[model samples]
Target chain A: MAIFRTCPDTGLKIHSQAEALIKANAVVGIVFLAIGGLFGIAVALTRWPAVHLLDPEWFYLVLTAHGVGVLLFWIIFFEMAILYFASAILLNSRLAVPKIAWGAFALMLAGAILTNIAIFQGDSSVMFTSYVPMKASPNFYLGLILFAVGALIGCFVFFATLVIAKNDKTYEGSVPLVTFGAITAAIIAVFTIASGAIILIPTWLWSLGFISYIDPLMYKIIWWGMGHSSQQINVSAQVAVWYAIAAMVLGAKPLSEKVSRSAFLLYILFLQLASAHHLLVEPGLSSEWKIFNTSYAMYLAVLGSMIHGFSVPGAIEAAQRRRGFTRGVFEWLRKAPWGNPAFSSLFISLVLFGFLGGITGVIMGTEQINLIMHNTLYVPGHFHGTVVAGTTLAFMGITYLVVPLIFRREIWMPRLARWQPYLFGLGAGGISLFMMGAGTLGVPRRHWDITFSDAPLSVDVPGTAFLMMGLNGVFAILAGLGGLAFIINIVGSVLIGKRRDKTVARTNPVVFDGGAAVAGYGAEGTMKVPGTVVLVATFFTAFVLYYYVNWKFLSEVWPLS
Target chain B: MAIHPPADRLWWKEPLATSEVIWIAVAFLWGLVMFFTMIYWHFAGEQNLSSEAYKISPEKFAERTEAMAAKYKVREEGDTGVPVVRPPAGTDIYMFGRLWEWWPVLELEKDKTYRLHLSSLDWQHGFSLQPTNINLQIHPGYEMVVTLKPNKTGEFSVVCNEFCGVGHHTMVGRIYVVDAK
Candidate 1:
């Protein structure tokens, strides 16, 4: 009956510890995301064949660093934070063990440290996907396995807490919209880790000569389950953010909570099965299997995407319509905040993920069509669309809306937050375009340089100018700096920033709870800040990183003996 | 479960159509690709997309290239004996491949519609047609056909794209398509 929170600064008891867990997740997510963004930049530099910032030895090491740092650690850790919010905060309950949440952070940090060490030592060069036989040092694989295992433990903790809430009968109905989406994402992560174990454990054994044969093709199949399926986990979380963002900025809720959850569940079902698409161009898989897996699966993957595309906007429309704007069909479009950082990140992320990543992913899934895009710069562009444009961008946008709520600190530079999105989106779009073009030109991926022509390769330098410019626009360093800017804002806001007035504190504790209180009208109220121009810059950094990777994957040639 | 619709639904509710119309059109195109592959395999019994009918080494391929050039055409001759040709990037080139198959003995000239019917008599060989970067798999029991025209002027490699056994990485072929006089 009573709202709980003891604010450390103002010495006020306002919200519960569960809310603290949610806020903590957001803070940790910010830190990890910035680091991951840095890794993204390094990876892009390594991938660009012409610039070739790091040597082949360091190139691959950094490539591994990039994948582990950005894809697995940063994104997944952020998802864990979201999971905390879902199980506790969104459920309108508190965390079971705040200390365990901190423990999860420590484990993730430990894993990240091991992986970075292994990579920088030049002991791991198997590329991000780490296909079999192109082996890395045992420590690298060990570090990854440990990291994932830790993440799985975190997922278990989340589920346990959710189960507690269920037992408590805290809700009058099924899980709330945001929590439902978060659970779906966590469930997908379960499969993601399980599949990863299937490949990694055995692969690690084989590297140490503990076992004899790990079929490259079979390894590929499972690895994608780890590699690609995990990305779907990212997608599920991204959709969750879309809901969160709408709730925060537009004061919107799901058009149909049932429809939204169904979409999340659909992702869980299809995403795992679709990893087979990664091996479409790989050796030893049957044509019958590849056809069944890749092409057929795209329909399912795209269907989930289409549902979100329509439903998310539909929620906005329905919410706007509820406001009685009653303008033209495009009226809701022009009136929306185009200048909010959080809005900009979500908007641009949606565009890049759906249009660019979705298109390239489908093209690569084709049995015969994969020939054009497999292992090319196009592949990086495709993933950037998903990870950078789709997941990371959305997560970043979410930060602006969430940090103020969870940390109870006003955003350091609201203007900068508003402008960062378009920069990233535009830069990434340009990179994706160039990557698709280079793929058409038969540019191979994961090479250190393109100075020498392998039999399958031909030299075409000046012709790739558009690609060079596109990548230069979005390379990882610039993106990393942008990421740093975002992280610093949040961290600074939490650590040094002053708390709001007592009236404001009493009125609301969580900054972006998204008005789920419904009829209850809980203690806290939401803020309606005017949009700013800074969101575009946030987008620029992400796009720059994408471009760097695209350039590298296209032109770089690693001298493999 | 399995929520796959019955094979004979009111085609509209079949799959992607019920999902997204644009994706439906794309899915239809993918279907056509699958159909073409099936038809090719049905006709050849085993489809291997290459122009080379005989198994030979790079050195031997050069010797055969001279012989096959007289029969067909030679585009660009290099001092290193690696001639270059442009086999439309996106099209598959099906030909017979064995451990020592002479790859692309027939050099394709620009803008020529050549149907490459391929298979292997020995261990599986790979016919990697570049620019499009599509690989035509050659197995003893499978035959593949590639329908293509010269799309660009470069030495597009016809490497043993498949790892048959030993000498897999070293196994390569070339297509040198010249400007038609």
Candidate 2:
């Protein structure tokens, strides 16, 4: 028999085992974030050119650690927490196997520790891609393999929990939209982990000298199958959090369930094909293959993102209109919970992700245009837009809500919480923009010195390139402070914040109507999202102008056939 | 609510509002436009990457690069003693990328096409030609052939953008493009 505790705030039954697991995964994830974030700051400072903090050896080593720690360990561990919450808590059902979940966490922890050890051991500094011939220690590959296996098992546990919910009839009708979104993430995780296993196991053996050689080209092709798909998993989970926050804060519903769900289905079909984007400038690939895969089968997956872009804010606008904030088209948006960190962060994530991440990603992924941008600072610039500004910020946003709801503790510093997202968002946004600017001016990525101070042949990088790096350094510090604030706030709240009492009002109640249909299709019985329509139009115009501008830039480069 | 299951058993059949329909249509059409634009570029665009590549042993590739360098040697660049080779227009010119440098700088003529053969001797490296900003991936055991026609006349720098150990930042090569006359 599973023990349960009813949350006084949300009035939902939470399984004790599942709650413990969620807390464990989330806390571990934050610990990795802290560790990796330190390394990240070091990287930014070193890249600043003015600072040039680390020596070449330490720079490469820290870069590897930062990538593995944050990208793989931190994100996945938090995703594990999300999987558990979406299944057990949302369905009001018990976790399928509590013991197995603990085992998975232990394995992941062991893997992360092992990988860090290998990185610090001083010979395994072959960056995250770990491209072949340039081998890291056997332990590095082994650690990643272990972590992938653990995550794969965790995905299975989530699936089993969903089955348990169905059989137990914990809730009526289909699983909640949040749970459905989580299901998409879990599905992608499984595919990604499997790809990791296929490529990594052999690489581990190769490192041990059991195998003579691993072809570099083949390694890249398969490695990105795991690497790029992993980021896709983040996209799915982040979008899910967006929906959850909107509903919790403002009682928002999807503008159309069919539209949103179909978009997610499009992800399942087309998103993984984007692994081709990395290989576009590589040798031995045909233009036809490159065109098809890089575009995600005619950019249908992009269509998926575009659809969500409209529906999410559209849902919010419609919800606000229903509450009688209907003086004008802008009234609904102006009256929104701008002070709420969760709401503010979600909005920041939406705009930055679409305008910066989404737009640049499509431009660089273009087969011909990639020639100008490949392996430049532009690549990192683009991902910072997606992963850091978009996914990481959104994850930070949700934590504010998670602290009070799941931990049953008041937020430690409410004032700090309100300002945290903007500080981080603005800082990260600047970093992305400046890095891209430097890249367009022909500054390379992963190089220790742009000035070529120590090289036989020198590069005459524009003075503006130095300015971009200087600005990146500044924004990095701001983002670092923002991250520190979040850590302090969460750690303080979890440890000593006042416990929630029955008398205290629920500011954002967890509302579920037992899957009962509500009357009215849109706000005020007629669909009206003039504000959202205008916002999306602005986004579309920016995207079009940016897309053509890149092609124009491509045209100016040296002619090639 | 997003945290709850659909209120209706048939949420799939729920009708979309006019705005939702219009937005989806516009976004889908945009996707189609971007998709076709790539295919269109192959026909009209001059900056597209060539798909010509071959498998060759590292030793064989190194041998070919040294032979070409010796045949077309003009003058050594600076105090480094690396040869600067000015291969004739429309010739098959070779540039080798390795642990620490792009060997034997090549000089080409403006507005003339040449087959530029690129390969790595040891680890994988990036063929990042700056100023003009053309980039490609270089892998050992494979040779990539790019059809290059330099429109501008000046010296261009090739910076290895891919991380290839401690000396990666130092891995730079040069190409001099002169007037066709």
Top candidate, metric lDDT: 2
Candidate number achieving the greatest TM-score relative to the actual structure: 2
Error of 1 at A383 (Å): 1.1
By how many angstroms RMSD does model 1 differ from the true structure? 9.9
lDDT of 1 at A284: 43
What is candidate 2's TM-score for chain A? 0.97
Error (Å) of candidate 2 at residue A240 is 0.4
Model 1 over residues A1-561: C-alpha lDDT tens digits? 435765432242333655665665566556666665665566566556555566556655665667777788778777877887667666545566667766776777677778778777875755677655556778778878887887888888789878877787655446666776788889889998999888899888988989875655466678888888888888888988887777666656543444455567777776777776666544345666666566444456555665676556655554555455446554665677788788778777876786778756765665545554556556776787788878888988887755665666677776666656766666556656666666556554454444333333343334574465347435455555556667777777777766665566566443333244232211011111111111222333443344334333322221100
Error of 1 at B96 (Å): 15
Regions of candidate 2 where Cα sits further than 4 Å from its true position: A505-526
Give the range where candidate 1 chain A is weakest over 10 consecutive residues by summed lDDT: A523-532
Candidate 2 per-residue lDDT, tens place, A259-364, comes to: 8888888988888997898998888799999999999998999999999999899988988877788888799999998989889999999999999899999999
